[model samples]
Each structure stands twice: as structure tokens, then as C-alpha cells.
Target: MPGYRKAVAILMFAVTAWYSEARAGDTPTYSISIVPQFDHRRIEAIWRPIIERLEPMTGFHFQLVMEPTIPAFEKALNAGAYDFAYMNPYHYVVAHRLQGYQPIVRDVENDLYGVVVVAKGTGHRSGPSSQRSGQDL
Candidate 1:
């Protein structure tokens, strides 16, 4: 099988196990994907616990895809390869413009917007700055 098929198979196994275990209750089928970020191993390690908790708590099958490159991820998202995704600002905006992606939920504690700042002298960077203070960031 191809890599995506393998991934889907693995995810399906996890979901199936979760579903069987949670046979007492109704469950929604979840399809989730994370955007490409700089830290792959670290994030994946951290997220395992989150997934473990989610499967039991939600009693739903989850399908998660983690990619390591933005260009490739964008291509995949454009192809509608995922049911849900966590993407960055530019990609989020672009995806909305191109493919109609919108945020359904966010972690209020840490889901702050992006910030762009340039040196006092040059002032040649692109985009505007965040109005919020650094303490929140």
C-alpha cells in the first residue's frame, strides 16, 4: 500500500480499537491533521498523550496526519486529503481564500495571533504588528 494508505490504515486501527472499547456510547468519527511545523518529533511525542486522552474521553475514532513540510502539506490540504487541519496564519488565510477553511475551535490560552516586528532602524519587514503585549505571547 502507499504511504497515505498505510497512514489511514494505522489510524483506522486506533479508531476501531477506541470505538470497540467505547461501545457503551455513541461516537463521532474524527479526521484530524496537523500542519507542518519545525518540530516534528517533539510535537508528535507530546501529542501522543493528547490523542490517548481524546480517544477515551471522546469515544471517537481519530485520524491524524503529521507532515514535515509546508509546501507538501498545502498540496495535500488543497487536495482535500484531510477532514480537519491545524495550519498557520498565512496558510489559514490562503486556504480560506482558496479552499474555504475556517476555524471551528481554538485553545484560548495559547492560540494567540502571529506577530511581526522589525528593527527600529530598518523598519523594512512585511505585515503589521500585534496590538497585544509581549507577556501574552
Candidate 2:
């Protein structure tokens, strides 16, 4: 399946499981936060449709939280402001450390990798840092 569809399906299953575990007679509204890689308008436009459909299917209300910047989002995420979150691996590591957040899914098809660039004659190679120098790129 396509990455987005697979992601949504996995999220739906997770949300459903959480919803079923809530205490009796308690109707909780969950918050979903996405990393602020895009502006609020674009983020909402992309996520709102998915959340709207999820609400009815899961029998739970969801609030989409959009932060204005990456730092702002990270601050909120670290503070445990969100019930659910979509974040980069670095943020995920911090979030898991600080808030004990458990990962429900990962996009194996679209893995994230870092690239390093340096001057041509700086005794640096383009691949791993070990090939270039002892210092990390």
C-alpha cells in the first residue's frame, strides 16, 4: 500500500485500541500533533480530512494541534502536550525519553537519511564520516 494510506491504517488501529481502553463513562478528546514542517494552513489541509474520518470510525473526538515553528512544536511535544504525535526520528527519541511515548508505526518505505557536504579539498569524502575523518559530519 501507499505510505500515507498505510500510515493512516496503522494510526486508525492504534487509536481504536486506545479508545476502547478508556475508562467507563469517560469521553475523552484526544489531541494529534504533526511536526511543523509546513505552515499551519497546509498542515491542517492535509491532516484534517484524515482526522475527520477517524473521529467517526473510532468514536472519539480529535483536536489537531498546529505549532507555528519547529521549536514550538518540540517544546509542546516534550511537555507532553499531545496525546498523539507525528514527529521526526530525532524528536521521537527525545519525546520517548521525556514522555515515555511509544511508537505505534513507522514508514519503512520512506526512511529518513542525512547527507553531508564539505569542500572538495578538505580531506573529506562524501560518504560516511569514518571515510572522511574521525569527527562526525
Candidate 3:
């Protein structure tokens, strides 16, 4: 009777060990997409190094999946295509409501003030950027 009890215990232990080991080999995954706030080629270049560095350190393998444009990114995100992403504040809010993405951190360089100048009156508009007051262009 004691031998039967011991055999069952060993079997349970082996199954438990195997189950835990199975998932250990899998890499954690994360993704970054276009944020509603700043959708520019420059920002993508700036963020590249940071994402590369974070991949190995955090043990989270990351990939940048680019679509046709900013609006495409939003569509993909709404479709639940990524495990995680870096997005703008307004995007974070919308995604949080729509896709259950929460803010883990925000960029230190997130805030910036923009200006447009007419070059003191050339009668021609110079230094006039396309962005309106609220959106980044």
C-alpha cells in the first residue's frame, strides 16, 4: 500500500516539473506602433536604438511592424494584433478604452512647444509648419 502512494507522488511531481519547463523556453514579446500624438519618420528613427537596447535587457523580444501610415497602425492596434505598444497620451487613452492597453511609462521628452514665424513680415509665410495648435506635424 505504501509503494502505491509513493508511485502516485512521483508521477505528479514529474508532470508538474514538465509543465513549468515547457513555457520557460518561450521569449517574452512586445511591440511598438504609431502613436496618435506624433506620427513622424524622425520619431521612429529616434526610438529604434531604445527598442533595440530594451529587447535583450528586458528579455522581451520586440519588433517594429510598420503599416502604410498612422491610420493603419490604429486599425491594427484596434484589431488586437500586438502584445504591447508605445503610443502617445491620447492614443494611450483611446487604446486603454478600446484594447485594454495600460500605460507603463511615458517618454521624458514627451512635451514640446512648437512655433511658427512669418520672418518679421516677408508678406510670404515662412517657417509656417502644417500643424495646427493641438496636433504634432
Candidate 4:
């Protein structure tokens, strides 16, 4: 299976098991926070299905919390505002360091890369051409 699909499956099962064993009188609502890479509406649209699936399996209410920005999301994460979180690698590292958050699973097949694109007719240069002697940008 694709890495993302596999990760989601693992997440579903893990969450279901974890919540099923919770204390009887505990709140049934769980909050899941996702990094704000897009607008809140779009983020909700993408993640709502997953949360809905978990609700039936675990018999718990799931709330999707989308922050306005990455920093805000990180702040909330550190404050333990979320019971679960789906974050980028950098955010994951910082959250783990700051809040002792443990990673449950990851999309191993997804490799992140950085690319720089310029206009076709522009004379922009990179590497040796873009750098001055003894200086880098």
C-alpha cells in the first residue's frame, strides 16, 4: 500500500485502541490539530473524512482544529491543546522536543524536497553564478 494510506490505517487502529481503553467517565471528544499549510476550510475538507471514519470505529467524537499559521499550530501543540496532531516533519521534531509528543506513524514513502523556480525569460542564476566570492545567499 502507499505510505500515506498505510499511515492513515495505522493511525485509525491506534487511535481506536487507545480511546477504547480510556476511563469510562472521561470525555468522549478528542481534538486533532493539523498544520496550516492551506486555508482552514480546505484543511477541514481534507481531514474531515478521516475523523468521521474514526468516530464510528471508536465511538468517540473527533474535533478538527485548524490553526491560522504554523507558529500558532506549534504553540497550541506545545500547550497540549490537541489530543492528536498531523504535522510536517519540522513541526514534528519541534513538537517532540518541546512537548515530548510521541510519533505514532509516518508516511515513509513521502520524501520532502526543496526546489527553486524562476521565470523562463529571467536571467536568474544559482550556485557559483549567484554567489559573490566568499559569500553565499
Candidate 5:
């Protein structure tokens, strides 16, 4: 988890440096919006401790913002309602184009890939069986 911690610390440093320059002396409160993959409570539970710990180290305050749904998250993200956001790569592309958001860091420990789960005996052999059955498709 050291790599994860280092990434987060670096992110906080970037945020602190940027915001500090924007408003010198005053502590800045940045809103961090996460994609609504999990419920709000779960997201908060997972992030709150980390943010709280970073506050003192970074000399900034963080507000965790969670949207109820993916659409709502997208809407907020498009509006640039957050200073920081944890989003999928697809959303990151859209955000970068729309809001000039830059990627400061990324998770390199695990590779993320989408999975399609279909019921057994459904004759859906291919992962997304549109043309043919099984991997031959």
C-alpha cells in the first residue's frame, strides 16, 4: 500500500500547490468527487480517513462529494463542480477535453478490464455474442 499512499500524497501536494498559489495564506477547501460506483456512505467511509489524514500534511481541507448515480456524476463532472475527481478512463478523456483536467497520477498496481457475465446454458459463448457464439465470433 506504500505506492497507493505515495500516489495520494503526490496528488495532495499538487492540489495544495495549485490552490495555495490561487489563494495565498488562506486554507483552501477542495471538493473531491468520486464516480458513483459505490453508495455514498461506502465511498465516504473509504475516503474520509485518508482525506482527514492528508489535511494536516497538505495544509488543505478536502470535501468528499459523491453523486447518487453515474449520470449525476457525469453531469457534475462536466460542470467542473469538483476540484479533484476519481473517475474511469472514459470519463477522464471526456473531462480532459471539456475541462482541461490533467492527470496527475494513476493506479499502476492493477490492470482494470471490463467483464461480461452471462448465465450458463444461454448459448452466449462469446463475451458479447452479437455475431456468433463462442470465441470464434
Candidate 6:
């Protein structure tokens, strides 16, 4: 989680730089959109401290934008509604490809891993199989 927080901070700095360059002589209030993994209140609680710290460091105000769902967040991202975003891996790819959003950092120490579960009586094998592509698995 610390690694994730660090990545978020680095990304914020990148956003600050971008804003400063793009809007010179103005203290831009940037909006950061996070993936809606949790409810809005919880997300605000988790990120408010980070945003407070960044405000002093960057000399800019930040607004936290929380959409109701991931797809809604993606829709706003495609519309360029945010200046910075903290998104999941798949959303990161989509945002980068479709919206030209560049990644400043990632959580290297804590990478995301996927798991697949099946019922015990289903006769399904758990191990990797030749029939399964990486995406299918």
C-alpha cells in the first residue's frame, strides 16, 4: 500500500508539472479521478491526506472526482474530464490508448495479481493449461 501511495504522489507531481507548463502564471486546480473500487466517502478519506500534502508541495489545489462506477469513470476519462487519474491496470491501458494519458509511475513492489476460483466438484483443473491463452486465463 505504501508503494501504491508513493506511485500516487509521483503521478500527482507529474500532473502538477503538466499543469504548470500548460497554464503558466495561474494556480490551476486539478481534478484527480480514482477508480471507484470503494465508496466515495472511503475513497475521499483514503486520498484526502495525500491531496493535502500535495497541495503544499505543488502550490495547487486538487479536487477529488469519484464516479459511481468504473465504467462511468472511464467514460469521463475518455472525455478528458480529469487532469490526473489513479486507475486500475486495464483502465490504465484503455486511458492511455484512447485518451493519450501517460503513466508517471506504478506500484512496483505490489503488483496486481488475478485469481480464478471454481467449485471443487466441477472437475475443473486449477493449474495453467495449454488450451488457455493468457487473456482467457
Q: What is the C-alpha RMSD, rounded to one decimal, of candidate 3?
A: 23.1
Compute each candidate's TM-score over C-alphas.
0.54, 0.72, 0.52, 0.69, 0.67, 0.67
What are the per-residue Cα lDDT tens digits for candidate 4 across 21-83?
Answer: 555555577678878877888777767878888887887888887888888987888776776
In candidate 4, stretches whose alpha carbon ends up further than 4 angstroms from where it belongs are 1-3, 22-27, 113-137
Over the stretch 1-137, how does candidate 3's per-residue lDDT look in tens digits?
23323322332332233223334467745455544344566546645655665544444565766666667777876666665455555555566567665433333322532121111112322112223222322
lDDT tens digits, residue span 16-125, model 2: 65455555556668788888887788778777877987887677788998988999988988888887778777887787678766555555455662111221222323
Q: Model 5: which residue pairs collide?
A: none
Q: Evaluated with lDDT, which candidate comes out highest?
A: 2
Model 5 CA lDDT for position 125: 31
Stretches > 4 Å off in candidate 2:
21-25, 113-137
Q: How accurate locally, in lDDT, is each candidate?
A: 0.50, 0.65, 0.45, 0.62, 0.61, 0.61
Q: Candidate 1 regions off by >4 Å?
A: 1-29, 107-137
Model 3, TM vs. native: 0.52
Model 2 TM-score? Answer: 0.72
- Residue-by-residue lDDT tens digits, candidate 5, 1-137: 44445545655554444434444577877678878887788778766877887687667787888888999988888777787777767887777677656554454444642111222222323322234222211
Answer with 1 or 4, whichever has the higher TM-score. Answer: 4
Better of 3 and 4 by lDDT: 4
lDDT of 1 by residue, 18-50 (tens): 245455657666556666565777656645555
Clashing pairs in 1: none
Q: Count of backbone clashes for each model? A: 0, 0, 0, 0, 0, 0
